[model samples]
Target chain A: MIIDVSDPADPRLADFVGLRDAQLRRSEDRFIAEGLKIIERAFAAGAPPRSLLLQPRWLDGVLPLLTRFPDVPVYVGTEAMIEEVSGFHVHRGALGSFDRPAEATWEALLGARRLLVCEEIVDHANIGAIMRVAAGLGWDGVLVSPGSADPLYRRAIKSSMGASLELPWRRMGGAADLARLREAGFTVVASTISPRAVDVDAFEAPEKVALLLGTEGAGLSREWLAAAGAHVRIPMTDRVDSLNVATAAAILAHSLRQRG
Target chain B: MIIDVSDPADPRLADFVGLRDAQLRRSEDRFIAEGLKIIERAFAAGAPPRSLLLQPRWLDGVLPLLTRFPDVPVYVGTEAMIEEVSGFHVHRGALGSFDRPAEATWEALLGARRLLVCEEIVDHANIGAIMRVAAGLGWDGVLVSPGSADPLYRRAIKSSMGASLELPWRRMGGAADLARLREAGFTVVASTISPRAVDVDAFEAPEKVALLLGTEGAGLSREWLAAAGAHVRIPMTDRVDSLNVATAAAILAHSLRQRG
Candidate 1:
C-alpha cells in the first residue's frame, strides 16, 4: 500500500531522523540506503528492507519489488515532504531503512583463514571502505569494535557501494570480546607504522589470522597492540608516514588472504 | 609584503579562481591546496607555493610564513572577497597556489625498487589516496596515464593528507611511455581479479617493479593486461567481488614493497 505523507512531521518517518545519534545510542540498529540501484542490489542479495520511502514518481519502478514483500509498508511522500522529513536532501529519489543483521558468532567469522578486525574506527566512510576491501579481497568477515561506526550507517552503506549489506560482519562488545576472539585460536595481527613492529610481510600467515585496523589519525592504541599476537608494519618510505586506515586494512587483508 | 584587496575581481588572484575548472585542465596545470596546515606542509617539503591568498583577518597568524617567501606574492582579501574570487566558500581560512612540478621521466621514477603506475583512474580522491599509499609503502614515485585525473586536483591533494606534494609523479603521454618503462627493465605487474590471473602473492619481487593499477569498475584494460609482464590478483571469497581502486593499489604496493 502506498501511503502518502504530506506532513513532514509525520511520526511514520521517525526511523530516518537523527540517525547518527540513534546509531550512537544503539537504539536504532538500522540505516538508510539511498538510490534505486543500491536498494535493488540489497534486495537481490536477500537483505530485505524494513521500510521504504519514495516519491510518487518512483512508485512505478519500485512497485515491482514491493510485490516480493507484501507485508512491508511502502511509504509514499511528496518531494517536499521527504526533504523536510529526512532533514537532508533526498536527491536519490528513494530511500529505505534496513535492520542490522544479527551479530555473527566468532565461530562463523573466524572459520576462514583471513579476517579483518576494526578497532575503534569511528568514521563511516572508512568503515565502508574497509567493508568494500574486505569483500573485494575475499576476507571471511569483519569484526567491529564497540566504538566503531555502524557498518549500516547510510553514508557507509552508500560508500561501500552496498558491499556492506552483502558482506558478513559482527560487532564485538569491547576488549572482552576481543579476548574471546584471542581465546578462539585466532592469531590477532595489529597493524601499526611503529618502528618496533615487524615488517608486515615478515609476519607468517597462520591457519586463522585476524588483521586488526585502527583509526586514521592515531592508529591502534598501545593497549590494543599489546593485546595482539603480533604487531606488523607496512614498509614505508621515511618521507611517507602512513596509509588511510581503510587502505591499510585492505593491504593487510589482501596480504593475509594471498598467503595461502 | 601582504597586499590587501577588497575587490574579488582583482587580476592578481586569477590563479586562485574557478578551481573546479583548473582541476580538470592539465594544460592550465594549476590546483588549490586549502588550509594553513596543508599549505605549510607543502612549503616545508620544498614544493614552493607560487602565491598565498588568505583572509585579511588571518594576516597575524600567517604573516611569519609569508615573510619567509618574500619573492612569492601574498594576496590578502576579506572572507567575502576570497569566496567571491574563488567561487566557493573559503572555510580553510587560507588557500595557496603552487606551480606544477616538472614531470618525472619513467627512468627517474623506476630508479627506486618500487613504483606505482595508474591506468586511467579518473577520480581525484583515488589518485590522491594512491599517491599516499605509494609514498607510505616505500614506493619511489607514481606514473599516471593520459586519461587519469590530475594528482594536483584540490580534492586529491586534500585526500592524500598532503602527501601528493611530497611524492614525485608524472603523467604518461602514450603507450611509448610504457614501452620505455619496459625497456628500462621495470617489471610491469598489472593488478586484476580475472579468473586466470595468478594470485598476487605469486609474483617474486624483481629488482625494479612497477605495480600497474586500473580503474575499479572495468579493471585494467585487456590490452594493458596483455602488455604487462604478469597478471596478478588479490584473492577474495566467492561472495565478495572487488575492492576500490585506491585500496587495491595500497594492498598491492604494500605487498610489493614488503617483498623487496
Candidate 2:
C-alpha cells in the first residue's frame, strides 16, 4: 500500500508524530527505526514493521524489503513534509515504525555465560553503546535496571547501529536481581573506579560473569556494589575523574568476554 | 574585573559571540569552555583565560579562580542574555573563552611511549572521547591528521570532560608523518576489523606504540593501513558492523597501554 502524504497532520503518520519527543515515544508501542540502514537491520532482525515514512528517492532502496511486507503502509512524502511530521530532520530521508519486540525472557538470560548489567544509566547513547559492545564482543545478553534508558528508544537504536534489535536483553528490577544472577552461577562483577577494587587486568573472570555498570555521574550504588561477587576497576591516571560509561563498557566487555 | 552586561550584542562580548557556530569559532583564536568545571580545567591546564561569561549564581564558585587571573574580564548576566549571545542554551549557566593552547612540540610527543594517532576522525565528540580515553589510560600524547576535528573545539572539550585541555596533542601534515613516529621509535599499529588482522589480545604490543584510528564511516585509508608496521583488531562477533571509533580507542588504548 503506497500512500502519498502531503499533510503532516495525517492520522496515518501518528507513529512518527513528534519523533523527537522522547516522552511521547515512550507512551507508544511502536519504535521508529531511522535511516535506511537501521530499517534494513530491523527487518533482518525479524522485527515486524507497522509502516514506513520516507522520501520517494529511498523507494528503490527499500522496495525489495517492502515486497515481503505487502500489507504494511509505505508513506512517500517530500523531505520537508516528512521532517514536519517527525518534528526533526530525518537523517538519510528514511524512517520505519516497528512493533517493539518483547524483552528477552529471564530463562534465556539466566542460561547465558556473559552479560552486562546496567544500573540507572539514563543516557540513551550510553545504553545503546553498552548494548553494541556487549553484542559485538560476543556477550550473551544485557540486563538493564528499571531506571535505565530504554534500549529500544530511536536514538539508542541508532547509536547501537541496530545491535539492540539483534541482541538478547531484558529489564532488571532492583538490587535483589543480583541474587538471581548469582543463583544462575554468574559471578556478579562490579565495575568501580575505587582503588580498593581489584585491577581489571589482574582479576580472573569466572566461567559465568555478569558485569555491573553504574550511572554516568555517581558510580554503582553502594547496595549494588556490596551485592557483587567481586569488584574490578580499570586502572587510570589521576588526571581525570573517570571514563565515560560506554567507554568503560567497551574496555570491560572486550577484556572479560569468553575467549576461544 | 567583574562586569554586568544585559545586552547580548555588547562589543566586549565579541569573543563569546555565536559559541554554537563551529565555523566562526574555528576562525577565531579563542575557544569556548561550556561549564564551570571545564573553565576551571582550562585555567588549571595553564591556558590563559580571555574572558568568562556566566550567570550571577556561579560567581562564588569561580571567584577564587578569577582572583588568580585579575586582568581577565568576567561578565555576569541573565541566562537568557548569555544564551542569546551564544545562539544556544549555554550548559550549566557558565561559559569561558580561553586562549587556544599551542600544539605539542614534536620533541615532547617523541618522548612518549603510548600514543593514539587519529586519521580524519571529524566528529568533534569522537575526537573528544578519543582524547579522554587516551588521557584516562595514561597515554603520553595524541597525534591527529590535519583534517581531523579540532580537539580544542568547545563541544570536543566538553565531551572530553576537559581532557582535551590536559592531554598533549599535535596535528600531522599527511601520510608522510607515519615516518616521524617510526623515526621516534613508535611501532605504528593500525586498527582494523579484518580477520587477517592480529587479535588485539594475542598481539604483543611493541615497547613504543602509536595506535592508528580511522574515520567514523571508513576503517582506514589503504595507504595508512599499509604503512602500519602491524595491524591489530579487537575480536568481535560478525553481528555488528563496527564499534564507535572512541569505544574502539578505549579497548585498544587500555590493552596497549604500558603495564607496570
The Cα local distance difference test for each model comes to 0.78, 0.91
Q: Model 1 chain A, poorest ten-residue lDDT window?
A: A18-27
User: Whole-model lDDT, candidate 1?
Assistant: 0.78
Q: What CAPRI class is candidate 1?
A: medium
- Candidate 2 residue lDDT tens string, B1-260: 89999999999998888777775676667788988899889889988899999999999988899887898889999999998988888869998888888889999998889999999998999999999999999999999997888899999999999999999999898999999999989999999998999998888988999999997578999999998999999898988889999999999999998976
Error of model 2, residue A154, in angstroms: 0.6
Which stretches of candidate 2 lie above 4 Å from their native place?
A: none
For each candidate in turn, the TM-score is 0.88, 0.96
Clashes of 2: 0
Report the C-alpha lDDT of model 2 over A139-249, residue by residue, as the tens digit.
Answer: 999999988888898999999999999999998888888999999999999999999999888888889999999976799999999999899999899878999998998
Model 1: per-residue lDDT, tens digit, A102-220? 76676787666667888888888999988888887777788898889888777788778888888789988787666777777888888988888987767788888888898877888
Local error of candidate 1 at residue A18 (angstroms): 5.2
Name the fnat for model 2: 0.95
lDDT of model 2 at position A89: 82
- Using alpha carbons, what is the TM-score of model 1? 0.88
